[model samples]
Target: MARYVTGAPPPSLDPAVVALLEKAETATIGHWRHWGFVDRRVAPLLPRRRVAGTAFTVMLPANDGTMLAHALDHLRPGDVLVVDRLGDRRHACIGGGLAVAAQAAGAVAAVVDGPCTDLEEIEEAGFPVWCRGLAPVTTQIFDMGGAMNVPVSIGGAVVMPGDAVICDNSGVLVLPPGEAEAEARRAIETQARGAETARRVAAGELRMGVVSGATARVTGG
Candidate 1:
């Protein structure tokens, strides 16, 4: 059996906010739809937590909740465990107990493209988890799943060990290898500008001036 390891630490940032904006909003996801790296269906089950670093993905034959339990034994701090339950909604791949273990093992967060159990427990532990929904049903480990970093699909995105995954209240976003640093800079700036515009609107600024001017520049009008 081979073990997975990150060659180096990821770019430094506040984990909470990093996870918050890492998601490609519906619009951005549409923009990257052709890139084949977006997961459009997963929803956040708990509050946002920063997620960065190489993706450490595990593919389970089904929703065997114990995969995270086993994987935590080797998961290092700052790792993002991406779990695939073969797109099964019959059971949850993660729940409260596993959330605590993953956090204790130093994982940044967990993203399950299937269901999850122990919603209250996960929230109590303060470990961020994003999943499709909640379900108490679970699959036995005997079915299938692997650890120590691997590539797997979530929604429609193919995530590899060590690739960047950004999740927020908006949605989940994957940053391809060698793209995190630059993309993060651009994302942060775009988000900040958006926030500023929102504030101005709250103070009664008209979109005709700010938004229209930007639209015209892009349209070359």
Candidate 2:
């Protein structure tokens, strides 16, 4: 027997907090020592787009997509749908129609641990999606049971509803709501420092080896 768990609605993060994270790169967020990055194989359908929002998680069975309908209804503006396909990489559980539905529901993006279909339609809809890849084969409406708004594992990272989700060209990462603001601050500082270092290097005021202290360390000078 399958189960459906509609947990409490996740709390939305402050808009300011979301904005801070949206400006930071996914790579910087991944350095927070948390297990939040989805697999590299799961990549964006459209290039150079970034999405940051609260997570609305979904868990699906191997060949069933019945619960996706329910998950769609739970979406809120600025929510990112994080779907866990339970290690079934064979069948695509989302496609063009589903992507459109999600967008209509105000979902900022969709990140799936499994494959997706109808690449052309998805791209045409302008809905950002990160998934294992494209597959002509799709899941059937088996009415098999699944869960919504529950913790799910995607690409070895456990995602909970309301967790901060950031997706970009680098990959997808989920941050605990409590840690998002602090981590965003750290990433911002890091980005600023990197930019200044690059500027100095470009002007010949500093060298890569001097900036990184690698030359002296390696040569024991």
Leading candidate by TM-score:
2
**Model 1, residue pairs in steric clash:** 15-50, 19-50, 54-162, 55-162, 55-163, 60-145, 61-144, 77-106
Model 2 CA deviation exceeding 4 Å by range:
31-34
Write model 2 residue lDDT over 82-135, tens digit each, in one string: 899999999998899999999999998999998999999998999999999888
Worst 10 residues of 1 by lDDT: 1-10
- lDDT values of the candidates? 0.66, 0.89
TM-score of every candidate relative to the true structure: 0.75, 0.95
Residues 34-136, model 1: lDDT tens digits = 5534455577786574445446677666645445566667777767778877768888867777888888888778888788889889989988877888887
